[model samples]
Target: MLAITRSLPLRIPTRLFSTTPISLSGHSKWSTIKHDKAKNDAEKNKIANKFSNAIAVATKLGGSDPSHNVRLATAIENAQKNNVLKKVIEQAIKRGAGIGSEKKNVDTALYEGVGPGGVSFVVESLTDNKTRTIGLVRSAFTKAGGSLSPTLYQFDRRGLIVIEKGELTFDDIFEKVIEVGAEDLEEIEGEDFIEIITDPSDTGKIADELKKEFTIKEVGISYIPKEDMLVDISDEDTKIKYDKFIAALEEISDVTDYYSNLKNEE
Candidate 1:
């Protein structure tokens, strides 16, 4: 649920955003494949499934009503955007709302580790089988020349909110956010965003307030790198090795999200 933001100190090259698309260009090929793969991958569909599960969980925690249950409402909205079946979403809401005898068992787990080039990696997983998921996460890190830590203190947790450009002024957002207990706000690339640093206790309140103003892309606790790694792995062999390591980590079914301290160009 964490929104990972990478700082772009310099603008991406204009050539990178060419209007006329050409075949065989690196950007074109990668973009084409990325779009195709995202549509075809079963693992990607798991996101919708996860949202359904979240709806159930939220409904169970609060009531089944969206107006009363803010979390459940947000989860349902996200599920709809991802094209989740309406029936499934309704079933989840009912189950969560306590209309059924289904037992709810949603677990949120975090895994911290160091990957190749000593880059810090934080993985967020949602599952019922914690033992199995943790083992799989550990194995993936080990196979990728990395190891997991039982305790990771090198990262900070912060609330991240993203809004489209010109939607709201920073002052309006800031004043409303502080009332909900936000710590800081940041603006990125003409897009309005706010980073609320609240104690774990205040997260829910802050989320509810922000959702009233801007569409919530994602919401959850995140492990942010204290310092980022800027290694020069421009060579093909080294790039391939790092790419393999990342791919392996991403392949784990239980790992919903992964974050790293590595820069985009690295």
Candidate 2:
């Protein structure tokens, strides 16, 4: 799944999986929350375990060969990016492929909700405990000044590809992206991004085509904010309330990626 971050002062949470200090400029509060959670050994371990589980699921659906299975391949890439051991990735693929699980009962699910100031949120989970996961998500939304609903139509699921600005020209990438069926492209200060509006089916092909021209900084399917809400709270208050909301959401083990339309003042 490709996740897109518009120029809405929002950040994707990939930085949480790394050790580098997050930049204050262009920093997304959700990204900060992820980084903070990863700083704790216990939380980091939990996230790693979840990734392992996802790997297992992906491998099971498609054989362990990353070369042959794009989903499995991407999952392996993410696991490696987060420093998951090679053995763990391999093991997950084996398990997912049903080499070990005699009981096939696991089910994967995704949940969508609204967050603070009506920000859209999407949570992806691979669990045997669907009831618990949904309950936890619902509670988070209620506590965060939002609620759950079936109307996910407000947002569009799209393929997001991010690359360094220096790697390619905007026009060149834009032309190629459109040729490959991308919906739109945007240029930020030093990063170039492309959003491909695709049915769930065309995501992989678009991703593969773009990678041939640019180094993929991050790629995942994500719910993008249809329209953003700008809040004018004091910096201190923004930090407090926004951080609190994000912290609470990130703690939910079932919430994989959270997207919001809320923009923070730099």
Off by over 4 Å in 1: 1-69, 88-105, 163-166, 190-195, 228-239, 263-266
Off by over 4 Å in 2: 1-40, 46-63, 94-104, 163-166, 192-197, 228-239, 264-266
Q: Write the per-residue lDDT of candidate 1 for residues 52-152, one digit (tens) a residue.
A: 65676667556788776566677787788777789889877765554554444645578888767666677776566899999988887788777996435
Clashing pairs in 1: none
Question: What is the overall TM-score of model 1 with all chains considered together?
Answer: 0.67
Tell me how far candidate 1 lies from the true structure as C-alpha RMSD in angstroms. Answer: 7.6
lDDT of 2 by residue, 23-101 (tens): 6888898987886776677756766776776676656555678776565666777778888888777666665665664
lDDT of 1: 0.62
Q: Give candidates' CA RMSD values in order.
A: 7.6, 8.7
User: What local distance difference test score does each model get?
Assistant: 0.62, 0.61
Looking at model 2, the pairs that clash are 1-220, 1-221, 2-220, 2-221, 3-220, 60-96, 60-97
